[model samples]
Target: MPLTFHWFLPTNGDSRDVVGGGHGSPATVSGRDRPPTVAYLSQIARAAEDLGFVGALTPTGAWCEDAWLTTAMVSQNTQRLKFLVAFRPGFVSPTLAAQMASTFQRQSGGRLLLNVVTGGESQEQRAYGDFLDKDDRYRRTGEFLQVVRGLWEGQTVDLVGEHLQIEGAKLARVPDPVPEVYFGGSSPIAGKIAARHADVYLTWGEPPAAVAEKIARIRGLAEKDGRSVRFGIRLHVITRDTSEQAWAEARRLLDGFDPETVRAVQAGLARSESEGQRRMLALHGGGSDALEIHPNLWAGIGLVRGGAGTALVGSHEEVAERIADYHRLGIDEFVLSGYPHLEEAYWFGEGVLPRLRTQGLWQHPFDTRTPPSAQVPFAGAATAR
Candidate 1:
């Protein structure tokens, strides 16, 4: 399959500096210059669409705008971009969630993709009135997907599970081209749930060997159950015209991280119940040193970030090479973001995507027309009046 790339909508806010806060950490609102208004988010959405991204992911959390509502509004601004809306399963009933997805698909012209988040933090989950422990939440997620899938298939689902109960549940009108479910977790239970239920198993950016291990494990489990799953990775990026410039840009973001904020965020994230978060913490060990965990792979972003803490930092060719490396390891999709999403979208879209196209690893998800001729050299062109 041709590689699919997706951009992020920074629903909490956008900033030049690293916007810390995800999972269990506090959302950094201080340096956020661009509030996540419909206009601003629509700008990013349109850019991603025009740049040939297949979709844009909108995150869900107490710190961020509601993913469903935000994406529903942003979807109207783009004709071709799908919205990978993230939502916690424990927060909403499966039947209602299915119905909402059905409506979103119809309204958005079948541009809906679901990212199922099984709540990982106890305190955050309780704040929303969910008391299930980490393991139970994964169990509940399994039941939730079962019910949701059945309804989307136009079946009368009746399942009496430990976590969820559904009786005679059916959608009035099934979603035409049912939305794909994207799920991720690092625990054993998470792998099991994903193998049995997920269409694409997502992972925070890890080294190629680690990612390959995950893919193998999930494939084994899925094969046992007569199923197969695609793979995706989430990461921040810093691609530039030259290697020196990209590394310098990465250094700038690293330099912006306040020592105290990193300490505090690390302390808060230390108490997280997520296995994935644990692995991310181990990658840097709460220190700023040796952030280049792998070739062109930087862990500096994970210093204050809770979830995806790594990034691919290098020139367009190097970044494209790193993506190709992961692709060889079985990653069919990439969910990527940067400090300031708008300009970064253009950087990666124009720079790296073209290289990938030349390598025959990617093609525009929506457009196939030959690109327009290169703009005439500014120095040679007549000045506009």
Candidate 2:
């Protein structure tokens, strides 16, 4: 199968520097130079769509705009671009969420994908009036998926699980094509729930060995449940015409990081209850030096970011090679973003995506009619100027 690619929506904001504010970290004021207005986000959405990304992931949390609302508005601006709406399951009832998904699918012509985020920080959850502990939150997510899945299958669900109870709950009009659930977590409980429920199991950008181990573990668990799930990795990218240019961009972003801000963000993330965040911290160790954890993988993003901190930094060919390596380890999807999303989308889309096509690993999702050479809409736009 052709590898699937997805981009991100900087709902909080966008900047040329590393934007903070994920998991438990506070939003970086300097990174908020370009506000996440509907116009700006629409430009990104249209660009990703024209560049052949399967979808765009819009995050949910206290730090960013609401996923559901932002995607709904953006959906009107683009055709054929799916929205991977990241949402916490506990804040809203499962039945209501199911109904909303149905409405979104119907209204947007089934351009909805759900990213189920079980809140990882205790204090952050409390800020939203949720008092459940981490373990309970995971349990609630499992139960919530059960009810939501049942209702989506057009069944009257009466699940009386430990965390959720639904009595004769049913959707008035079930979604024609149910949105695939994309889930990520690093704990044992999280692995079990993902194996049983998620259609796509997402992981942060880890080293090849670590990522392979995770794929093996998840595949085994899912097999036990008589299910198979696709795997995806989330990372930032810094591809350029040459290796030197790429590293220069990485250094520029690294240089832009304030020493105190990195320290403060790392300190804040230290209190995160997320196992995934813990693994991210392990990769970089909150140090700015020697950030290349693996070939072409730079961990500088984790210095101030809370989740998915590593980036693929190299020339376009090198970046494509790294992606191919991940694909060999069972990653069939990639959800990626960069310092400035609009221009970076073109960098990877025009430069690296063509190389991937040459290797027979990818094809434009919506432009099968066009040849590979004509796939990227702005292939020569930069030079044409």
Candidate 3:
């Protein structure tokens, strides 16, 4: 299968410097001056659409804007691009979530994909009125997906699971094309949920070997459930015309980091109960040095950012090669973002995607209708201010 690429909508904000306040942080912080306006997010959506990316992932959390509402408004701005809306299963009732997804699909013309984020941090989840521990949250997510899946399948679900009890729940009109579920977790309970329910198992950008090990783990678990799941990696990218330019850009972003801010964010994230977040912290150890953990993979983002801290930093060709390496390791989808998302979208879209297309690794999702020449260029595309 040709690799599917998705860009991220920085609902928190975008900046030339790495943004802070992700999963376990105090608040959404874009250290740079830019604010996350609807107009700005729409520009990103349009850019990702024009660049042949299949969708844009809108995150959900206290740190960022609401994914469901943000994506709904953004979806109105783009015709073909999908929105992988990140939502927590425990925050909202499963029936309502299913109905909202159905409404979103109908309104957006089937442009809804679900990213089920079972809240990882107990303190953060408590702020949203959820007191479940990490393990119980995963259990709730498993039950939540089951109910939501049943509703989407046109069943009158009356599941009385330990975490969820939906009585005679049924959607008035089922979603025409059921949205695919994208989920990620590193804990044992998380693996079970992904194995049983996820259409795509997502992971933060890890080295190829680590990614392969994760894929093998999920594949084995899913096989036991008599199911199959695709794999995806969420990453930041710093692709440029040359390797020197890309690394230079990476260094510039690194240089912008305030040492005190790094220490503060790292200290806060160290309290995270999430295994995935712990792993991300381990990759960089909240330091500004030795960011290039692998040949083209940079772990500088995690210095402040919470979720996906690693980036693929290299020339266009080198970035494409790393993507191919991940593809060979069974990563079918790539959910990518970068600092100052709009410009980075152009850099990767114009410089790197073309190379992937030429290498037979990717094709524009709407290539049959929109020709390459007619497509908008990311560099000069109007981000209507």
Candidate 4:
């Protein structure tokens, strides 16, 4: 299948300088400037749409602006782009969640895609007065999805699971096209939940080998359930006109990181019980050195970002090569973002995507009318004898 690409909205604020605070971290002052205004986020969304991205992921957490609201407002600005709204299942009742999704789908013309984030950090959950531990939270997510799925299917749900008790929960109007559930977790329980529930299983930007291993693990569990699920990988991307320009940009982003801030953030991330967060910390060891863990794959983002700490950094061709490598390993969807979201969208959209199209690996999801070869520069090259 042709690959699908998605961009990210830095609703947490963005700048040329590194913007900190993600996952468990409190919104830290980078001492840099940039506010996450709706206008700015809409700009990024519009750019992604123009660039042929299928969707834009609005992250959910205490560190960023609310994903639901941000995406809802931003959706009004773009015509063909979907919003992969990241939201925790535990924070809201399943029935209401279904209603919100239905309403969003109607309002946005089926442009809503949900990313189910089972809260990973206890401290952050507690801040919201949710005291469930990691395992219990996963249980809640399972129950939550059960009820929400039933409601979305136009059934009156009366589910009495261990973590949820919904009596007669139903949506008066079912969503015409039920939103696809995008989920990620590294724990054993997480794998089980994903196999049982997810339409698309998501993972952070791990190396190709690691991603393949994870895919195998998920496949094993999914086979037991007799169901198949697609896979997606999320990462930051830094593409430029040339490989040298890309690496220089990567180095500049690394240069701005304060060692003390790295230590402080790593310490906080280290306390996280999330296996995914732990894996991210191990990638770069919270250091500024040796960030190129693999060719065109930089671990520098791990120095401060909690989730998806690595990035695909290189020229458009190199970035396309790495993406194809992942695609070969069974990644059909990519959720990519970069520092200063708007500009990076242009870089990746104009740069790597054309190359992927030339290789016959990708086609725009929203532009079914436009023939692929017509839109892609190297399409004729691909067909040449």
| lDDT tens per residue, model 2, 35-90 | 89989999998889888899999998888999999999989977789999999998
- Poorest lDDT segment (10 consecutive residues) of candidate 3: 371-380
Span of ten consecutive residues with least summed lDDT in model 4: 368-377
* Superposition TM-score, candidate 3 onto the true structure: 0.96
* Residue 318, model 3: Cα distance from true site in angstroms: 0.4
Clashing pairs in 4: none
User: Each model's C-alpha lDDT?
Assistant: 0.91, 0.92, 0.90, 0.88
Clashes of each: 0, 0, 0, 0
What would the per-residue lDDT of candidate 1 be over residues 154-186, giving only the tens digit for each residue?
A: 999999999888899989999987999999999
lDDT of 2: 0.92
Error of 1 at 228 (Å): 0.4
Regions more than 4 Å wrong, model 2: 27-29, 369-385
TM-score of 2: 0.95
Could you say which candidate leads in lDDT? 2
TM-score of each: 0.95, 0.95, 0.96, 0.94
* Alpha-carbon deviation at 324 in model 2, angstroms: 0.4
Of 1 and 3, the candidate ranking higher by lDDT: 1
